[model samples]
Target chain A: MMIPLADLVTILPELIVVSAACLLLVLDPITPSNKKDLLAWMSVATLGVCFVVTAGSMGDRVFAFSDLVVVDGYASFWKLLLYVVSAMTILLSIGYLKEERIDLAEFYGFVLLSLTGMMIMVSGADLLVIYLGIELMSISLYIMAGFKRFEAKSIESSAKYFILGAFSSGLLLYGISLIFGATGSTRLVEIAAAVDARGLDDSMILIALMLVIVGFGFKVAAVPFHMWTPDVYQGAPTSVTAFMAVASKAASFGAFLRVMLEGFGGMKPNWSGLILGVCILTLILGNLVAIVQTNVKRMLAYSSIAHAGYALIGLVVAGWVGTEAGVSAKGVSSMMLYLAVYSFMTLGAFSIVAILRRGGEEGEDLDDFTGLAKRHKGAAFLMLLFMVSLAGIPPTAGFIGKFYLFMAAVNAGLTWLAVVGLIFAAVSAFYYLRVVMVMYMREPSPDQEGETRLALSPTAFVVLALAAAGVILFGLYPWPLVSLTATAALP
Target chain B: MSVPVEFYMVLSGLVFIIGLVGVLVRKNLIIILLSIELMLNATNINFVAFSSHFGNLSGQVFVFFALTVAAAEVAVGLAIIIALYRHHASINVDDFRLLKW
Candidate 1:
């Protein structure tokens, strides 16, 4: 079979990432052992180039490789977000890797590769393409999660993540097969059209939809399917946890949006109720459970799960409002904006955790953060900003994101769900505020009175700057990003 | 020479159930990993069965991709298990409670 050259060009972002991974693999041995920072810079540069290429394809829609893959405004938007998150993650990982003594080339290489997989997943128009993209992303993540092989906790986290991830993939594949058998097509657009033509029974469609939901729900860490998140997030390195919280969440949501809007547009009525129920459970359970956790990382883990629930509200509204009214666009755009803001805040929070590590020990417990304001005022201020933003306080991006999502819900007539979400939002505020109070009100430990030193690495400074700037800038003037997201409609 | 679709579905369901049981009940980490592989293979079988039934090659192509993913998953899974074993010197799931409530 002769492959079309044009299709390859359309997927240039993925190609760039794969090539970068291979280059890192080959060049690591040749470089001196002490100069591994060069590899880190190279990885950052590669992500930068990939971002540029992805941006170059903006506002241009094209189907490639017999429609197995697509390049559209939606794909470009998600690809850009993924690249940005990946780049910031690489920056965050620099000081983190040095502090932890894990200066391996393959760590950065796997991050890039996983990012490539995410890019492909967002753009994939066919079942096979989506599956490949998911695997590509997941396999790399499994390795990256366990990069600290000497740490037993890291290894256990990797194993748990792998087992759960594989199980979900199996469910997804089986669901895809069932849908293919029923509709006789694996192409998303074709599947939609087939279901329309044949008018499949409600039961069969429900079963298939349930399987897909279970699979993607696992990816997004939705309730009843989120047993592994806190363990994995707490056990993985802080930088990798940041990547998982941001990039993986965004990627999974991207894939979810595509599948629902494109593949199962006609079957919205069937799956909407299921999603609503899961969203409610996730919101209540995730937030309520997070309050009792003393480990800051685990709290953030549960917070991530709660945020997934919030994003699901947008998805529910998108499905409920139907496509003709353009409410789906608004809902999805809110989701995108929320994800963008979320990435910055979460990364900043994790970077603060990484900064507090002393002598290579992971001091991420809540007590470790007591009197952080006195020790490192700048880091404390940034952490306070992140917590406030995460709590959806006004003058921060999180508030605006939540406001738009609630507005979308009301517009879609999901008033009850919106009210439930608002109540949980209030409940979630307590934990986020607890972090701020600890930073500001509590006194520092009496270990050493004179050693009030703040270890401000250049990388931590960048992380703080980007996160604080992103939250404030996007909070004050979110219209531009909102318009950009609204314009990037799914096909 | 036609195999019924229900037969394949039933077989896949059985395989999936067994895998689920192993995942939920197994004490050894390696056994859990093996169970995940079994689940994936069941999915592949369903994909191939559907492909043949529909007279479309996409399902078969999907099966090949699934196999590749399964292999990759196994490689990573075993590597993590080995790392865990080296650390704790045992593969018992109950003993791996570093992050429990």
Candidate 2:
């Protein structure tokens, strides 16, 4: 019944996050509605502390709690992303919730709780721990999605996300049980060792792998499993969409890598083919369908799915060829880099959408962005950077992210896959730059000419500015993030 | 007259298939939630079967966690349905179509 000291040390970041969430919940009752922003600010500060603690506890590669959790560079890398994404989402929400009259303390609390779940998910070494973490993150997200209680779209978003989320969880759980049956263990290392010892020709192992992929495919919004993404992204509050698109997706990818690389590393060739097939389908559908969408949020939703395809390339390469050093896995590091860059660009893009929401109307329609440069130059400029970067243009993080992913692919001798990804990247630029053209070239219409400019809250402005800075800064100087992810590549 | 482990697994697989079919085919929100629970319980049955077969405690241990998670999931599921019902005035999955492609 005794817990290990190593366990406590490893769980320190999670404890800090969850405890802060609980404190905010308790304090919410006494605090006035007008001052709910305090909870948001406080939550951001707590996440900041989590970032620092995770950074500080980075030296040893220790597996705690009987190796159910790992305190390694990979965990550290993901925890940092989770904290930054949650913090960015909170800042984005403060301006957003105020404009919409959704000034709730629980919103901040849930953000922290959900972030805590992601932290657990990336750190988890056991299948059971990973599944529980996913559930915790998913349930919080469903409630958060429905935060705009009276709105039908918001409620519907919550409903669809929950049902599908639960269904996927069931599939994932069944897969885990099957894997357990085949290997007689749920620990990832033991599973891998079992695979090594027994070999990969077992039909049960193959079925379990497919079930697990479907579960994660739904999470990452990959093509055959991306039915919920557009609706959820369009319907959920902009801030929540940003959270789901980046942090939740990153967590899913993180768990996916851990399971594939660690748990099923022995059968890399098997999962690699399946990942390659889905990656191709995801790229084509996400880009092609995205072009037809006029709604900006939904476009970005599909864009996120396409980005998942690009990251999947890294997964394949990492499995097939691996990283530069070959000692540490290169595949996950590139995927991590892509997700981190994506978090900034996508959130920056969504924060602009959040800024547009004033007087109760969501400014997500494509026409809503017409003549934005004329309306507000600074916001328009930031949005341009996000869009350009998202299109993988130079001098932005998005380009650097895609570059690392493709380079990893080429390094792994996946030049053919990289070529396919390049074609999709070119196709993606059309939709992304279409936003740019609308903002800069189009003129305001008769009625829209004198419409008042959307007010940007200080926090939201700061959020957008931070995201923009990260995009350009990382793009220009990618080595720091590159090295960090490399160190965190394997265990 | 002893039952083989394969029989239990077949039973669980049939139950799991029925539950999955219910989830995909049923129209009622509450029934869909129940179907999900059934799917999870089928997994629970598998876990215990494997645990006994493997003579390890982890599979049984996994069942407890899965059951607890399913309970929590249902609570959240029902809460969301209530919220949805408040707005749409119905609990049918087909009626909840505020979002589409």
Candidate 3:
């Protein structure tokens, strides 16, 4: 089969990233251990180039590969965020990998490869393409979660994630097959037309929709399906955890929202209620469970689950008021903005968790943060800011993200759901503030007296600085982000 | 002269449920991996059944991708199981509980 040049050009970003990943893998064995940072830098450079290439295609909608994938403002918006997150993950890992004595160049390659999967995921307009994209992304993550091969926890997390991930993808693929059988097409546009023509009474379509939701529910770490998150987050290397928490969730949300809104827009009444139930359960369970966690990583993992709940509100509203394209746009854009703001604060928090190690001792437990203010004011202060933002306190981007989501909910005549969200946001503050209190008020334990020094490598410092700047800058001036998301919202 | 599409769907659905149950009930890591493959192949069966019924090639094309991905997953899954076995000398899922909440 002859492929057209236009199709090739449309996927240039994905091609570039994949080739760079393969190059890094080939170079890994020959590259000396001392010079592994060079591979990370190369990955970051490749992401930078892909970012620009994707930006050039922004604002223009182009379908390629027989409409299997699309390049549009919506996809580009997520792609840009994924690139930035991937670059930060690589930079943060440079210091983290070395500190943990697991500095394999293949780690960087996996990051780029998984990012390529995410990029393809957001751009996929067809079910098969999206499935392939998700599989690609997931397989890399399963490997990255076990990058610390000698460590039992790391390998265990990898096994758990692989089993659950493959299982979920199977569910996803089954749903796709059912939908195809019902509609005789896998393209979102055709699926929508078929759904509209068939009306909302089709049991097959409803079953398929539920299965798809369950599949994506597992991917985004929503409650009842979030079993793997805490273990995986707590066990994986902190840098990889950050990547999974932010980039993976964002990509999943991007594809999830697309599939729901574009493919099943006509079935709003059916899905909105189900999603509302999920949103409330996630908010309650995610926030409530996070409070009892002793390990900081597990706490963040649950907190990330709660964050997914908050984003789900946008999805619910988008479906609730699906008849009005204008109102649904607000819901969609709000979700996108929420995930974007979420990316920064969560990444910053994990960066601090990754950096606080000293001489192979992991500083991941809540007690390890005691009296951090006295030991290292800068690191403590950064953590405090992230915790504050995460708690949805004012003068932070988290508050702005929440504000818009709630506003959309209220606009869609779901003020009660907004109240439920607000209550959970308040409940979430207890844990976020506990971290603040530990850093500032409590005393460092006797045995950990000299061991809590911050290992601030220059690359990690840059990551922290970037994340902090993003949180504060977007907090103060959200118009730029608001408008960017508004323009990127699906038409 | 040909098997009805509904029969294929029913057969695949049963296979899928069996795979899911195996994943939940099985204690061995390798068995769990094989269970996942069963689930994936169930979907592949559904796709092929639908593709032939509809006379559309896209569903068949999807099966190829699914097959490739399933193979990749097994490679990665076996490698991880090997790593876990190296440390614990066992492939029982219950043995790997150092990361519990």
Candidate 4:
């Protein structure tokens, strides 16, 4: 079969990323170890090119590969955000790998490869395509998570993530097969039409829906399926953790949102109730548990889980409004806005966690942050900004993201859900502020004195600056992002 | 005689349940990986059954993709397991608890 040029053009960004990754791997052998930064820069350049291409095609909606994939405003929106996130992650990793003494050029290659998966995921129009995309992404992540191969904790995290991730994919495949049996097609548009015509009473469809939710729930780190998150986040290389927390989560949610809104749109009444239960549980557990954690990474892990809960509110509202198109779009657009906001704050927060190397010891413990205001006022101020945003305080991106989601919930007549979310948001403030308190109010312990030093690398400084600017700029003026998401919402 | 679709569904469902139980209850890492394979094969079986029943090729095509993905997963899973084994001589899931269960 002859493939058309038009189909190839539709997937130009994916092709660019994949080929660049392959090129990087090929160039890795010839390039000396000290020059791995060259590979990193090359990867960043590749993302820059892909970014321009994706932005250029943002207005076009085209299906390619026999309708297996699509490129549209929605996919382009997520892809643009993902490119920025991945680029920042690569930039952050250059200094991190040197500091950690792990000089593997293939790390950048894997980032691009996994990014290729993510690009496919957000653009996937068929279930099989999405499944493949997820596998690609997860497989690369499993490898990246254990890049510090000698470290037992890192290896353990990789193994646990692998076992659980594969299990979840199996569950997802079973759900897909069942749904195929029910609907007779694996395409999202076809599935939506089938469910619409057949109605939602089929036991097979219901079971399939539950299985899909469970599958994606694990990917998104929702409650009950979030067991692997803290361990994985805490154990993986800090740069990898940041990427996973930001770009990977965005991609998973992108695919999840599409699969639900397009494949199972007709089953909104059914799924909204189940997702509501997950959301409340996630918020309660994530916020309360984060408050007690002493390690900052683990705390952020739980906090990421809590953020997932906030994002799920958008999904629940989207479903809760049932057949109402306008309200549902609000829900979807709010979800997009929340994720976009989340990428900035979470990436910024994790970058801080990544850079704070104090005299060869990682500043992972909350105690390491004591008297940060005195030691490095700039770092402390940035951390304060991120923590405040994370807690959803006024005049920060996090607050705006949550406000829009809550407004969406109220509009969908789920005012009680909004109230529950608000209560958790307030509860979340305790831990976020505790970080700020440690930075500002306390003095460094005598034992850690004189030996401690902050290694704020040049690239990390750039990332922090960009992330800070995004948090402040979007926080103060959200209309641009708001309108962007409005245009990108699914029809 | 051709097997009925219901029989295929029931058989695959039972296999899927058995595999899930193995993944959840088994302590050995290899057994868990094998269990995941079982779950994937169960899906493949269901897909083939439904494909023939629906008189369509998409489900069969998906089985091919699933098989390919399952193979890729094994490759990656075994590599990770090997890394885990190097860090600790044991392959038992209970033994590696440095990062809190």
lDDT of 1 by residue, A286-326 (tens): 99999999999999999999999999998888888354457
lDDT of candidate 2 over A313-333, digit per residue (tens): 878876773444472266678
lDDT of 3 by residue, A271-347 (tens): 99999899899999999999999889999999999999999999988898433777789999999999999999999
Sort the predicted structures by DockQ, highest score first. Answer: 4, 2, 3, 1
Q: Lowest lDDT 10-mer window, candidate 3 chain A?
A: A319-328
Candidate 3's C-alpha runs over 4 A off are: A321-323
Chain B TM-score in each of the candidates: 0.96, 0.94, 0.97, 0.97
Q: Please give the lDDT score at residue A211 for candidate 2.
A: 96
Residue A491 of model 3 has an lDDT of 61
| C-alpha RMSD in Å of predicted model 1 compared with the true structure | 1.6
lDDT for each residue of candidate 1 in B7-80, tens digit (9 for 90 to 100): 99889879988987898899898898888888887877787887888788878887888888888888878888
Docking class of 3: high
Candidate 1 deviant stretches above 4 angstroms: A200-202, A321-324, A448-455
DockQ list for all candidates: 0.73, 0.84, 0.81, 0.93
| lDDT score at residue A152, model 1, on the 0-100 scale | 87
| Alpha-carbon lDDT of model 3 | 0.93
For candidate 2, the TM-score of chain A alone versus the native chain A is 0.98
Task: State which candidate, 2 or 3, has the greater lDDT.
Answer: 3
Candidate 2 regions with alpha-carbon error over 4 angstroms: A321-328
Give TM per candidate: 0.97, 0.98, 0.99, 0.99
Candidate no. 2 TM-score: 0.98
Q: DockQ for the candidate 4 complex?
A: 0.93
